[model samples]
Target: MAAAAPPHTDHKLGTPILDQPQLQAGGGTAAVTEKARTLDHISDNFSKYLKSAYDDVNKRYDLTTKEGLAKWLVTEQQASQDDVQFFKDGSFDDFIRYYMSGSASVMRPPPPLDDTYPISNYFISSSHNTYLTGNQLSSESSVDAYKNASVLLRGCRCVEVDVWDGEPPSSSSSEDEDETAAPKPKKEKKEKLGLRKRLELRFGRKGSPPPEDQSKPAAASSNQSPDQGADMRIEPWRSNVSTRAEPRVLHGYTLTKDITFRAVCATIRDYAFVTSDLPLIVSLEVHTCPEQQEIMVEIMREYWRGMLVDLPLDSSQNSEEIALPILRDLRKKILVKVKRAHKHPGAADAKPSTLQAPSGEPQRSSSVVSTSTSSSEELPDGTKKPPAPKAKISEALAKLGIYTGGYSFKSLDQPEAKIPTHIFSLSENTLMEVHETQPAALFKHNKHFFMRAYPKGLRLKSSNLNPSRFWRAGVQIVALNWQRWDGGMMQNEAMFAGTAGWVLKPEGYRSTSDEATQKTAIAHHNLDLSIEFLAGQDIPMPPEEDDPKDFKPYVKVELHVEKHEERNAQPIPGGGKSKGGEFKQKTETYRSQNPNFGGEIIKFEGIQGVTEELTFVRYVLSALSSSFSNCNR
Candidate 1:
């Protein structure tokens, strides 16, 4: 029997677990053998069975030579009956199954529950198996917070406000302020002199000032001021100075200001984890002088593609496969991902060596078109030209429960293909194309697009554990754009992007109430949450004794849970005149003995995913503003 393993924390996730995944030891003779065996588990085969199936397929489909499969990767042409495919890393077969990417992101399973993001700060994933932290769930959550902040500022409408004094108009100089305030006897003389002086300074005038009559003293200015009978109502007018001249108005004007980045981040941080059904569309505001916003958006799109689309081709260094430099050169064109848009001919001018012909002949054609989009050529009906039809295998190369494709792809007996198995073209069936392979852009349903530059798809066993609604209490967040979802940006459908955060449920949540009875009880493994990060005082210490260095930068999230589902708080443990071991039996008990208590200890640990990135969108009245009894806004 295997020895019981000691309790250990998963290094990747920091979660406490009892599993010892058998990792291959490092290189040496023994380690090499172990590694070989491990590779067998992932991919091991001389592939005699697959080769036989391939022969049968060739005979049935009337294929005459190896040229019929020159386009296939080495592993693809010889996969076994049960071989799995995904991410272009697998065999050429349309009906393949099994995920190729290991798991979403590089994160380890969650640490003990107590070490997680504060439940207050992180919403429970629908399955309650993992979490998302950073920005709020919906783009609306951030938007609403921003609107609230703006409205509050409007309400305060402080008696005084600060606005930057613009670079003085070309005709004005900083030195003119002193010149104008020098107390000229005639008010007009002061204005005229300063305006002229500033203009002369800017133009680099070479002349000296006009001779002046004795400038009046302050007492002399009072008499020259508006006469009692004259019209004292001085209308604010265009100054008498020339159009090129300017007057510096330091104290009055309509002052406009921007929402700060820090405030934006705070607003978003405060509400990102509230559980709610509100729409979560995100608009990444790339405010570039207002005029360049559109260009900025384009740049962002290109950046995502450039970073993610090339990851896989960059790794396709093995000897037996056709080279795809175009696939590697992701800077080709930025196309919206809809329909067959992800497909663009790699390059028309480049050597066609990248795309292999089924005949093993290098495609030396002068023109080769990709099958992803409609042709650029226009037709009489105003319809764009359609793509060239790709060649396909006319018959299933597989037969009953084998690499031959005649039988249901899944099992010999579970069920027949619910429908025909030829929905894909022959090439589509043969090569397992990895969808989430590059952290490339996933999809942009509404205004927000989902992205991943790391890890892969995550498995969610159930969606019903979702919290019914999200509550936004204390976040100041930012959103660059906002619009009603035309196609619809539902909260639950938001992808976990590194830049944007989400707080929503999963789709069509399925209940994990119980599995179909298997006769033998099976234990489902959960990503465990460790409770060890709770070693410090539950509440913070008073300020004076607190040293600056001890301040932790993150918001410490704690899980407050019911003890044994309400056992009337372990009756005062100390000083009851009770002997040390008097309650030994009760103390050692796993469940509460109080007649009031019921149910078992929670068997599943709460798991969470942290927001690996964050940014300030805007700031507003934190929902926590009410908690301090009117201390500060």
Candidate 2:
């Protein structure tokens, strides 16, 4: 039996691997003899940087020589014999240089974005619950635990944070004495109280008292029934707790210790524009009192003053009708996504509603300052929901959300009503249903306004929705839980790895013309994508019950596009087979760790050019269910 392959470590996650060298020959098939010039012709001069980057990875290889260059190009580029021959012949240098220097893995750079398009026409990498790293019920909330870095370094352009009134208590001493005897630490308590005061001044205060008997002893709250009294006597002693004095960031009802919004702002300021130079969106769920609301705005102005994209109060552009500035125009800018102010009834410019709440579901108000509480049955992910807001957002906070306004999304039933210019967010459950019911309408809406989709409340463990589905529907910001490192998260990373945070929308999805909105007619042409499987290096082992000894590895390539009917399909069968219009691939079996299929080809016949452009291919390796000999049969 052959030995199991060691895990591959050379290629890090989010790094691009050139599995196949894209070679284009001008007229003759013969390898060119002239030495390829350095990549000076390209508009973006990254040649010097590329050379240095390659050297950092491979200290032993000398890119100037044939022997060293040949080895590096073949391994790094996954170059075929023709490519290797061309390299040795000195004609492949420019192509090699381009691959090493370009941002996109596919030889050429993607087309420049159309600045004229609305913000919704660009795909944005986003995250949910930027505070938590575990299940909602018990996850710890911290600023340092892979928080801002995911947005700054990991291609995540949008982040979400739930803001609540008052500073979270630092220790048990602040609680009522009946709950604990320990005295409060003065330093910690002072700092928290100070922060709360500042925020109160910024947001207006309703000056309401704390809930009655909040610090009452648990024993007192219990009924005087003997059974309840007995249970309280047996329960362990705990510290009495009180309401906070300032606004803090926290997950829903989870008793995870909270951090102030100041920390969140600091994180954004320090890391903003560090990774990709694109506009970063902050989706704020504000539940703070009016004073704290003002504080939130004040802090934003103090810390993020220069970088914020403040909308002009008297600007003639109606946010509901106009596209905002392009991303390049908003570099280093923080675009705040908050709820638009309540519209007056019978207002002269009152537009028809462009959205419909799901059938039988109550219509939620568009106020960010106020929101309806979810019943236990409707609570997300089995985690306890937090109490309703204690106060509405202040006028100051509402004014701060001018440029990048936010709205709660319903359904696509109301086409006449239009969403505001800035943002609209929906839970994954709501989005998937909308896609199923009115995919075209959803796509059309996305072209005009930014749409964000986040995980459903039921994802208690912080699982994520498939971003591909959301992206296909033209949703700009498909937020995922960055804390969980699942396949969904990995794929999300893959999609944004080499490109900037924003990717242009597909042509058909970019315009709202009836012809573009209609289903595109597929062009038929025989196309062959031949892959030469030299070997898979350091493939990971199978899980338990799948014997490592019985492993028969093969590769599968899937084309993500509209599925074509099998009736129109034609496949070239096995001994290495090709299946057009279908995603599955077949290759002769190899039992060893480095299984070399020599040259296996996957072909696609009668596929349209539009399908080809929108196509994204995924490569996966798996063990054959049966023994190698049987699989070959």
Candidate 3:
């Protein structure tokens, strides 16, 4: 027809354009072209492509048809008219590239802050030995540690300060020289002793004679105060040999250096609320004398001013009956957590002092007190000796423990454990023991009161414990060594990602009803997850490597669930098997800088856990021939 209009050809290629509409017997050229275009668009299958690219995009956007997708593209992604048409007409490569190139976030947005709950019903980010930058045994201490934790890290609500008696500024003598000046024979004799012998020598043993230098009386005994004259035996591990009487912060019983308490307080005051306005908890480990303790109180009062929480007056209300204040009530306040001393027989009747709040009416105070004492020493003949006397807490420092009163954790059945304002501190080992043996009780107790778990004393290298284990048991504060950025700290950062370091415990954990407990007991769920490894673009060569052509990249995916003995011990009522372990999968290696995985899907089925909220998925992109690996959570 018109010479069968020479089959439409591309001039540049000099080839027949197969995509052009074919001539039909009864249809006009325009109509044929339009029909062929519509059929081609249908053949391209944009819907299927979009679904594969984003598995849940349609469900998330409430999209049913192409029109809805077009609207979403225009409104949410700010697509141009031409781009919208292109997307609708089956051009998905550009869209996938945009999404995979970090143009859109793959993670769910952080939930809004919910501060209406009781302070006990949240997991607070905390740091252990906040002043130490290296190992627990020997490290340089600095106030900058506090600033890093508070401002740079942004959301550390609890910090530990070990306050010891500081040396006077005018003191010229150095303990290092004195120790070095000791007879070489004495040093050799000390080193020859066994562990038990050394311990017996450090503490006063029943049969062992005291060291000659320590046995001698002090020159200033007549003028020394009672606190200064007390038998404060020097532990062999302590490197701080200062005899001055100012309050300083350091790791007790270790070679860690010291930072002035005033500098610490000032640093904390200046940076505490810079990142978050939530209440800050200072876990005061008081190793100072009463005089220095008073100096600490004065420095805190001067630096914190109106921000420090005042001690509540003695009240008729039972501490066990009162509940902890909500987050709203403690905003912008600094709460000192120290072991409260037992009050004198009739100290409740004493007149108000500057320590008490200005209000004349009585206010409730926590009934918790520390019951822990120094460990008993072993005799030379292996007989057990009585425990050393417990160190006395200064009254001034004890009174500074306003809202949170520190208590030595014994057992969940203890009477003090029921007090709302009482906070129990447990070492990582003890925490693990309790979690494995009594998870239900620990979870229930944490719902009403606060509990903190710190790294055990044996973590001399500053390694961190797995915080997720304690978190699963509903521990409110799992203090970690912030200096190490290992898996534990990465998990911590993820837990507090979108909040001000305080994440509300799950509803089942926070609820106190019997039904809620039952719900939490069997909260396990089975999940089926499929991750599609599509393609890679412009992958960089490994550092220090010579050629990009030698790169062979692959991705390994892992699904990790924090497993606990408690959850496995009690299975769900429906006879479901415990599925609490790790799942790993990997993709085939590709030999190019821009590797195309070609839609290889990795499927994880029957992945189960006590709670899905604690599950984590990790992806590691690694090279087959190289040691380069990039990890993402």
User: Which candidate number has the best lDDT?
Assistant: 3
lDDT of 1: 0.20
Candidate 2 lDDT tens digits, 362-437: 2222233443322332343333443444445554465456556664454554322353465667876667566656
The best candidate in terms of TM-score? 3
Location of the lowest summed lDDT over 10 successive residues in candidate 3: 21-30
Q: Candidate 3 residues 1-633, lDDT tens each?
A: 010112232111111112331211010111132232232121123335555755565555544456766676667766544444344333355445344332233444347768898888888888888887666655678886676422223467888887766655654567777677756448778888755555445433321234777643455545545664333332211223254445778865444678899889998998787657788889887755444555676678779988998544334334334456778888889989888643345655555344434454222221223335435434443544445334446555566766688776678887567556788888866776776567667777877788988876656656677676677777888888765544455566557654566777777777444422323543677778898876765565544445777788888776656443346434223222221125688899998777778789999987766365665565656674332222223
Give the clash count for each candidate.
54, 14, 0
Instruction: Please report the TM-score between candidate 1 and the true structure.
Output: 0.18
Model 2 global lDDT (CA atoms, 0 to 1): 0.52
TM-score for each candidate, following the candidate numbering? 0.18, 0.62, 0.65
- Deviation from native of the Cα of residue 519 in model 3, angstroms: 6.9
377, model 2: CA deviation in Å?
A: 5.6
Candidate that beats the other on lDDT, 1 or 2, i.e. the better one:
2
| Descending-TM-score candidate ranking | 3, 2, 1
The number of residue pairs in model 3 that clash at the backbone is: 0
| C-alpha local distance difference test of each model | 0.20, 0.52, 0.60
